[model samples]
Target chain A: MSDKDTTYQVPIGPIHPALKEPFMINFRLDGETIVDAEAHPGMNHRGIEFMGMHRNPLKVIPLSERICGICSIVHQHMFTTAVEHAAGIEPTNRARYIRTIMAELERIHSHVLWAGVAAHEIGFDTHLHFTWKVREKVMDLLEYIAGNRVNYSMWTIGGVRRDITEKMYPKVNETLDYYESLYKKLEEIFLGDPSIRLRTKDIGILTEEEALRLCGVGPTVRASGVKKDVRIDQPYAAYGDLDLDYVIPSRYGYENTGDVFSKTLVRLKELVQSIDLIRQCVDQMPEGDIDSEPKKAVLLNKLKKADGEGIGRIEAPRGEAFHYARLKEGQEELDCWKIRASTYNNLTTYAPMFMGEQIADIPIIAACIDPCIGCMDRAEIVEINSGERYSYTHEELHVLSVEKTKKILEGSL
Target chain B: MNTIDLPMSLDELESYFKEGLGDSISDLRKEEIKKGLNNRPVKLIWFTVSRGSFRKSIELISDIQIPHLSVTSGSDLGDVVELIYHFAVNYGYPGDEVSVNIKVHLPKDDLTIPTITDLVPGAITTEREKQEFLGIKVENIPDSRRLWLDEGFPEDRYPWRWDETGMENMSRYVHDKEEAANPPTEDTPREGGGKDE
Candidate 1:
């Protein structure tokens, strides 16, 4: 209580949107500068792993996709791959290519959707609307391929449930071409815009040492000069066949500051990278069956008798995530299933990033990680000395962020 | 963050561990799942280590490079809790990364494993998680306050355990009342793993 007498505690929380996974953070502040930020995630731990463990292997496929609303494909892909590896079922080469294409398309849409959120966080609604509008092409492409916008239930135990027929190639190419065309404009707006640079540059810096020491992943770590992309490091699916490089800030001559700006740069570049990867997969796709074991009963029987543990790690749009699965002989359900999302690894890195940022920078910094769920729903500022308590709604926090942008534009504190 | 000129293959890595921690390792397996046009090898080495040598094995891994700790995946195997430390090495090099999963089985009575947060600070999350979900005590974890589960939830009942301490009685399906109350958890055949979750 004595320490609180000289400091304030700002708890931002209950970022629970529609009862999905939620997150919260408590910021210890002296004046407007953040001294330390402690994150309290798991506000709504749905016990999906518990749910998965209770069901059969085939039944868990749909359940896995429901783990994350944004990256349903990532969970589905990882679950199937883990089960397949345990059961010793090799997916066809064509199926791997199809999976890769779908994963990349999801990345495009996720990153684009994040751009809008980041824009909104910084009070740039115009950019948010613009980016959201630009995001339709990728979402359309995903829906066209998988038949669903969000939960594209494409994965089966052995392989994908659907095929990317020759007829779909034209649509896929058109979508990729659309992103390629808009890439420069998207870059100019996010990276070239003066206001965004002012707000993001030198804000929420996570040094390379901290990034590595904390084991950060995906664009979050890549932005900090850590070359830890799962696609390149360990090629799963069609990533081995496709030539790719880590989308670190240094690749394009920008310093790896690990700030919000560098993170934005990394995600934007990854957008282009994903487009190129999908094109590579399309060009090099082999002709074969999409599903290795189409009959659910047959595959279920195989998984039930399989006795092994397997791992599926992927470079999700957010970062590196993995699913671990174990199947014992004669067991109808999984013996063990552990789902580790990228955010879990990146969670520790937040304390370092928020060390010296202003309270206004919290929203953008939190959004910069592109956490699976919205995290800035509301905030309560506790003046510890007086024991006075008041809160800021998500909209009020948005105003503070926008006001910071306006102050930067006006050249006044 | 010392750099080795050439990353060792999965075989060499396995041999390194066996030679270094001889009797501490068991059930050693090295696999490569080939994929796509190039048939590039995705290597993985699975080995179970004695509880005493768990930290020692991690120290051996750090000798090569600051291992990228993916996550520690674990489950309750009735008598012993099986904790698998899923780590990745040779990260910078393209297509050279090997997943080294070190399994440590602790008797339910002991239910304790030393923390690797000293070697991999990032492992605190997974360590704390293993502590809560499976009721495994993470000895000397820097900060052991509950991570995922809230303060109100019953601390004694771990969700992952399929035992008396587990949430089996509480975990249920809406329609399957009888099935939920008396769930089928039968064959714990090999190495103490259960038949079903």
Candidate 2:
């Protein structure tokens, strides 16, 4: 690794075999070691937040779900909660419980998806296949319960648009049992296997201090030994009533190795917790009206005065998602609405993590944050060589990334 | 937690801005604010004013020191370009949700306002996106980088621009498509579209 040796620059991209979405990372490599790294985002800017203002308030529900497909329910929940706050309506206890069940279901599906992705990233093809196979059950259950697998538009302004009937309870219970059993098997595979440990342990180590400074959220922050779960800090929905512990890695079986393994363990354990929470919601379900009766249609026809400002904070699967809205006196739509995804705050740490790490470790290290790649797809990267600066298109980078990743996987296998 | 009660009704909140803040607020009505549909509270207040007063209004309202700037949303309203700056203050506490709305209207001709990045640092990235998308000039903002703007996109082109018909005509062309398709050979021209052969 001497200075005279020819150094190579490796670009992992907006689309690669390892990632489902778009994001680009450039690694300045000295041999196998990554000496420097830079992350460029903005590749998938849909301008959905801007669209929120122009569209009708009711129409925004479907639009909000499009914010992030994997975490669609959370997006809908956040938007609906903000609308509820704006409208000054408090949902009933049963409605809160139903919302919590949906939220937990989403968390389970999201974590399982990440686990599968993590497996694929590390060249664990069998594990990847197995995890996704089990994940299909959860997705199927989601579709059965919410009428759709990805974006469950169940949440409405005042309460859930639909109710979980008694007939649905048995199916819910069966699904929970199946997921829990599958989780046990997956847990053994992820934690008990030596290869899994070797690939992840001590690699992509994000220390507690780095986690705090970088404002990392979700499992990434939890794995680093920070006990800042939004469920505990600001409990919305039925989470306020549940006697559940925020499953941090430090509390459980694993010592804080500050590595990808720790993050994996935290996410896996949270999957179990999500299942248990859903079970509790279903068992103690109260019989009540699911939807609020619509007020007089005449009241809705009038031009509602927009007044006051409010902030809506929800813990999306990635981490804390925030929305701010202000209403003007006579405008039909919101005067102001601002959204900050957890990834926006957490992505800043990519540079530090990538630096001083091996190029092979980049995928897992980067994916450890579970970044919202779609959010950052709009950015373009230009490389400066000698005096000339050449721009790299996202498509070019994506193709190169997939080729390199496939090569790496074949070599590792 | 106990239910929080605020001193002002939705109309009072609107009046506070109209008389106290001296700005025009829109979308405020007693019926909208009072209606509790599905047990969810509906709070409403609207304000509209000249676009020139946006920065000042933001500065004045944000003086209360709300820790979080939740989001900033911009929309095209045919004749006038509307920008909304949402601020959250002490809403969690009982009797404290007196949220303020300061609306600023920018005529089609002049669509620029002073950037509030100095006051709220978190607004840096979102403000840049809005500026480029809506063709709004945010003066005094720290970072001027073209966030979503890249090669093949015109400097003045806006992605979210809606004309009187509310259609976005901004096109994102592929400037490097040719270069990508026919990569530079050893003898191609390097400076321009192709490397010297």
Candidate 3:
């Protein structure tokens, strides 16, 4: 705790206030500058992969959706696509476009949600409120399409559960027009703000070399100038039919410094790109059956007969989300199911990014990668060794967070 | 960005591994699921090799233009547990990306394989995870600590295994009033509770 003590180590959390989910970070510091850092994630692990193995292919779709609250659609999309791939059931062209539209809509909402969180971390509450207000439109569109706001159970093994009726087209177009019109305003608030630039421009810089070496994916890698996107590379859904562009920082005015600013720019550009993608999917959507085979019993029979494996991946809002599935012939349950969320790939880069950053920049730097511990938290119910259930109530957790914030503010932490 | 003779199809990619690695890979099979439900053709190359050649096969896979290590997952396959290392090659190119799966089967008697963290440091997390959940010991891994499992979690009680010693009872939620009233508790003599080493 003393300034003279060179070997000062500060442990952040298994549960922290700034983070949306629970994950611990230990920072080894020399005075105020971090010399080394380690991230201990998986506090909220629900053992979703383990759960998926016991359930049939048709039943695991909803379980996959619960992997993360933000990127629920991406999880479902990947899992269903993998199962569909393994079963050799090709979805109708209309179904593929619908999937594409839903995924892009999810991306728009997710990016805006992340922008608000990043803003709040920097103590800019107004930006958080405004960004979230604009984000509601996307959420509403999602709710209208799938009947739920967060985990839309739209993805089925063979095809989507619901169809976008002709009545919904005007509503979808209106939402797109609104977002396109607000793009300049959103850019001005996020990119043009002087304070935002000052806080994020040079902080948490991840070089292209570090990015590739660490296997960083999604916007995190894009921010670093490594032009890789699973959407562009392995064009799934309706992504192949539509013309696409990779959203990298250098394409805009910013240099490929891979800083928090670069990441922010990439995400903002992606929001616009996602808007364009949704428009394209809607316009080019063909008229056909959503499912190759609609009956549940027949679909299950097809999956049962298929003795093969396939891997499905998509560029989620944060990064590349992958699902690998193996189905044995004449088996009700999955032979093998593995999910690798983007946060899992992105977390490896944390040590390098946090190495030389000051303690004050920890929140922003950590938030810059958009680390979602919920996706990585694969916890299991192990018997408590202490023979005591020491669980915190919501109020207690809030009070503890407030006390920690106070300590951080007073600079005694 | 010079396309210096990239493998044009799944067969070319498979032959590249065969010609390049020789007998290091004991069994090799490529399953091409051509544009099934999507435009992306999944070229899955299943490489089964002896435990001794596991790391070498990965290094050879890395030599194929530094493929991104997607995820390393394990499944209990009767007497042997199959550890599948999924890698994505040629990203950012539409319909050119290949899913190269290098699978190594380790018998239940000897549950260990050399770690690829040195080749792909990003693989440390997945290796650690496979070490925990599937009980597949990753030798010479940079970090030996548990990745996600709780500290009090009993050792050798892998969740993925449906066989004996696996915690299959907890897989599904059954409303047992007796178990709920008094949860099982045995002190695990481990340091840092559940923190990584």
Candidate 4:
């Protein structure tokens, strides 16, 4: 084909390595720059919202946790808060603190995990390894406190299931101190390192206007200088009492450039914010009954009689995790259930961010949002008339991206 | 003394709607839903508008500085599907989020509503979802292609519906205890549950 006739379309997923979860991005490229892009995500669709409506109110907490593995505790917290609202159940002060502790710890681990993934996307293997090595401490603490590493079944309708006893205080404090020490190391390596700065500084710029118009949440919008955090705006659990500061890029001495670098800074600082929140929860935890009634029988009995709807919106490490539950009077099951996971709202920002960016920058720019495709992966690429199927593995896409980067550098693109 | 009894922002949001929408609103109720130990109450303001005022209701809510459209959920009420559009009012105002949901009931025969994608681009995915799962046709949606389901999947069969054709395999979960107590003979194995023994 002639150079004028060679406009190409690239299919980059359904299954990919640059992302931790499954989703597809088909881009229409004009030479070296992306002209337009379409995201197809459903490969990981488990119909959790649909399924949540079918199950008993109490049983859906664990199911909701599976919506995003990385944000499991956040999901549980959202679901429980909604159910607690509908049922008119108030968790004790201690339970609120415990829930906050668990959610913030999850945020720390999740943000650290995202940092490693972002580092890997930029071809920094040592940085990825180092970031993940620091993540293990938080993971171990999660295991020690909640008794599970990934999906900590810590939340219930009225309160938390497990209490953070006095004995666990030492380990929790130690983990917080451990994460505190790594903050400088993380910033020095990810932000101070010249290569990372070169790759991420002005790449994939998303302005505050675009962030607001697209309804970006969590770190994605925070990095773009929107001081909107669900925890700060609509405090749930112990967030109101924590007196926390919003962790945006501007606060860390960087003008919000709304780029991959800003995104990295937002997440890294959130790691620090989460650690402080957890320590505060530990220190301020009061002695009280964890739940109005700890038994599932009493909880379910109470919920079955609830006759109202409640909205639970929390700031997951990624962004705002929202859950809406309607419980009709005298019904054991939910009338309607909807989950707007943070990643779902953030997904809309991708097409805008992808515009005018180089192929090589796609991985990190797309990863900059910290997308959790596990919550949203219904993807397919098909020809309209012929019904022909097209797909690309993560390796093939990565190679294509890297090749384009090299071409641009050689002035041959 | 329940902690959930605190004053809610839903009252403020309701008054905003009452002043803005006026006669367009059919029903509005603000309820204090959840209470936190530190006096942060989670509040919900639910209102229903006629299908004619659905678009106006959404526009008014957006005008009230609540541009964040969280999610839209629907439930099958036999002949009608009640669609609830949830928005976070007073967003970015710390500890003052009032969830204002504008609900509209669309009949099964006419399952269409004007798309909010133009007003809020973030709503495209959720609108696409309702189109696929709830079988609610979003009129003027930018992309009408199936969002979650494959092209080859049955177009008439919606996953969230409670009709005879929908969720056939999942009938056990949908059916009430009385119906579930006696398993449908068609679902049960024939002749002592033997496989060509």
Candidate 5:
């Protein structure tokens, strides 16, 4: 067969084989190696922006929170911040601190969940079970604070709907302590485990230049030693008063390799940093009304009469995400609304990371970004010359990944 | 409030664009919102550049620092499509980041903006999204295929637009539009009460 005939197209999802988020990555493979990769997202686009533009500003809060199940707080924070910015309304100082704590708590939960998913992707079920079991403490805290584990509608336009009152401080501290206690063990399993090191080290490497050119966000880019965290770079809410630094891989004597290992390193370290940040917020949280304009009628009237543009940017657990909100005078609805999630920017970096990697590495590399992508489904492989097709279910993909791990353990890979 | 350890301040950026783009730049404004106990300022610079000077303004910004393009937000504003390029500069320097939002008004008749993928490779996603949603052609985009909308979604009907070519015909707003056409005078009450009616 000619060299051209050897190329095969492997489409691994707009039907995700990983999590429930639907995203498709089409791979042009030469033999078992991925020659090129492209991301096809939007299978799950509910047109949230369209819905947001149609509704009044206040009604859009719940809609924004539903944007991503994993990062609901991220969306709600951006939406409220954007609306508040446009309307020129300052959230109470206490509200800012509460927002910071909630955001940091969400970050911890998200990163811990991501750790479990990453472990599962590499066929480490025990690690997955352990990480997930450990993640419950934060989830419980979140539920206690916001009354909902997933879509915590704690945010309002001017301020927040909920407060991190003294009643909830003990639960928050206990959760933080639980994670802090488990941090070292979690670190050892994901970072120190030799098998995981084999699968992740120098695998799916994205250089700093590629990261910068592609505008990759979150730990995905920070792994490459990029200082682009929104929290540190542009302080919003209580981040301005708080002290924090970038969580790049090099900070702990590791090279900024921009590999899957570096990415893991960044996330695991951030878990500790998140714990520190939440504690700072709890200690320094001020005394004031959680809601700036508690009267809904007054807030709604102000919003309807406000005419301006605002942008809300946040450093989500995954990366830097922002929302654009425009309010017009005498308009009951938003003049314009745009929500840019972190995965949207990180999607571009997939091309560079997937290039020249083996098919077995797809799951780990794909999950490395902690993608808030589309739902999981089966993958189909097409052979060009034969015009033949084969399908791989999620179970089959998991098997392939597990088998790869076995091979690596046996030193056959 | 936007204290920076870097050489470039928010004011310097304002002057830099003025010097580089000259008359093409208009509606220049610098805003800093203070927050938190420290009262730290979140700095932002908003300005408009003629479509002819759009790429030039970005290049001038690039001369000082490698500007990070944080997606573009586009809207269908009556006779023109407004595209705002939100770029963040001085990221490595902590607490010094400035959101330089550059606006360009593309007339509805000629809805085209040159692709900045060459300058900002990551902009391809947002640019492609703008093309499919607003029906504004991104001039010379490397990959111009639709990003968000389905293949079966009508090509002529832009969802963001509220005009004849927009999706208003099939939208719920279509019914509301007819009702809105009639005036609500002193005899009739508005949709929401004037003072809790």
Candidate 6:
């Protein structure tokens, strides 16, 4: 096609080499700048929310875990809390403390995962490998406590399913100490590297005004100088009791670009804060039943007339997760259950952020908000040729197979 | 901060709503429930009018507009589908929550209701998803685009349909197969499948 008749369109994903998931984005580019972008998110719509309404509360707990693998515990925590709130039962003090510990542990693991991904995005493979090696400590601790690496069904309706045993305290402490040392190493790598600063600083900048208008939550909002945190504003899960300081990125030493650099700094600082919070929970341990005795008589009686409405909001690793449930009398199932994740609220602003960014900076810009592409169930990539298309799975790119190398060597050598 | 006595009678709560919102209300009653539960005071009020009357209901409670729409939940209860619009009003002075349930019944075929999206933008996604999921058509909604409907789940397939999914059949077959394969033998009544047996 000649230049006069040709149109420049970049199709990203459904199958992309960079992205870890399946879904596509079509970007209409004009001279290295994105003019218009369309997002398609139905690649892995498992109908989890629809499944939640029909499944019994007990079964829904595990279903929630499958929503996002990285933040599996937080999903179950939010769902169980919503159910408990609807039933008008608050977990015991001991249970609340246990819940907080589990959540912070999740935050530690998730942030480490994000850091590794961010490093890999910027062509820093060594940093990625080292960070992930450190991240295994947290994952191992999770396994020891919950008996599984990923989908730990530790959260129950009224309280946590498993109590923190006395034997696990030392292991938890050792894990925290390891993470503390890892944090210092990551800070040195992220903050001290000139190439990383050049790549990330002042790129994908989200101003305070834009952040507020877009209703961006969590670290994205915090990096933009918004001091609002759900844990501080509406304290839950023993966060109110813990005397920990909210970590906000400082504008002084680092350039307050409100870009990916600032966001990375904020997440790194929060990692340190999470480590401290875990230590506090372990030290100031409370004594009581991890779960209150089941109110069988009340539940059975209420099961007949137990129709009520309740809203449960929790600050998950990504952002605030809202669950609304209503019970109808004499109904064997819930009348209605509505859920809104933080990512659902944040996706509205992606178009505005992607508008003026250079085509080369798309990955870093998207990662600035700590974009959970998996949550969106979508991918973002650019197609260079019109008729020719290329695609690769995440396993092929991230986890290189032996066959890939054998073919390449056979051809080249 | 009005502290209503515990287990307040249905008549007493009706008078409170009438006095609170100066409008002549009717059909205020306690929803039927099983006994032996910890009974918290609740009142359901149904307006004796059409969709336009919702504005009047809103105006009556304008003074107490602190009410948050907990959720706009719809369900297909087999016979007559029900749309339970739950609103919880938080009085600053009182530390308690006063929940009011406005129940509207729509015929199974024509499950259309005037959209409340204009009143609350947050309700837009929930209402649209419900319309697409349960085949409840919410009229006047801004974005009528199918949210999760692109999955070829079929219109009104309602993944929650237990009879259609045949989970019972699957569970029964699996259970029967397990029982037959490992029938409790007299030598090993507990079915431990010991080497001796």
The lDDT, on a scale of 0 to 1, for candidate 3 is 0.78
TM-score of each: 0.94, 0.70, 0.88, 0.89, 0.94, 0.71
lDDT of 6 by residue, A91-181 (tens): 7778888888999999998888888877776667788798888889899999999898889888876678888977999999999988887
lDDT accuracy of residue A160 in candidate 2: 85
> What are the candidates' interface root-mean-square deviations?
0.7, 6.7, 2.4, 1.7, 0.8, 8.2
Question: Candidate 4 local accuracy as lDDT?
Answer: 0.77
Indicate the DockQ of the complex predicted as candidate 1: 0.70
Model 1 regions more than 4 Å off:
A1-4, A16-21, B1-4, B173-197
CAPRI classification of candidate 4: acceptable
The models' CA-based lDDT, in order, is 0.87, 0.64, 0.78, 0.77, 0.88, 0.62
lDDT (Cα, tens digit) per residue for candidate 1, span A329-404: 9999899999999989998998999997898898898888888766467789999878899889887887888999
DockQ measured for candidate 5 = 0.64
True contacts kept of 2: 0.10
User: Top lDDT: which candidate number?
Assistant: 5
Q: Enumerate residue pairs that collide in model 3.
A: A13-A24, A45-A377, A45-A378, A45-A379, A218-A319
RMSD of each: 5.0, 10.0, 7.3, 5.6, 5.3, 10.4
TM-score of chain A of each: 0.97, 0.87, 0.89, 0.91, 0.98, 0.86
Question: Mind sharing the TM-score for model 2?
Answer: 0.70
State which docking tier applies to candidate 6.
incorrect
**Candidate 4 DockQ score?**
0.49
Q: Is 3 or 6 the stronger prediction by TM-score?
A: 3
Query: Which regions of candidate 3 are displaced past 4 Å?
Result: A1-4, A17-19, A374-413, B1-4, B34-42, B170-197
The digit string of per-residue lDDT tens for model 4 on B73-175 reads 7777789988888887667667777777888999988999999988888889889988898888899999988867655455666777877536554443332
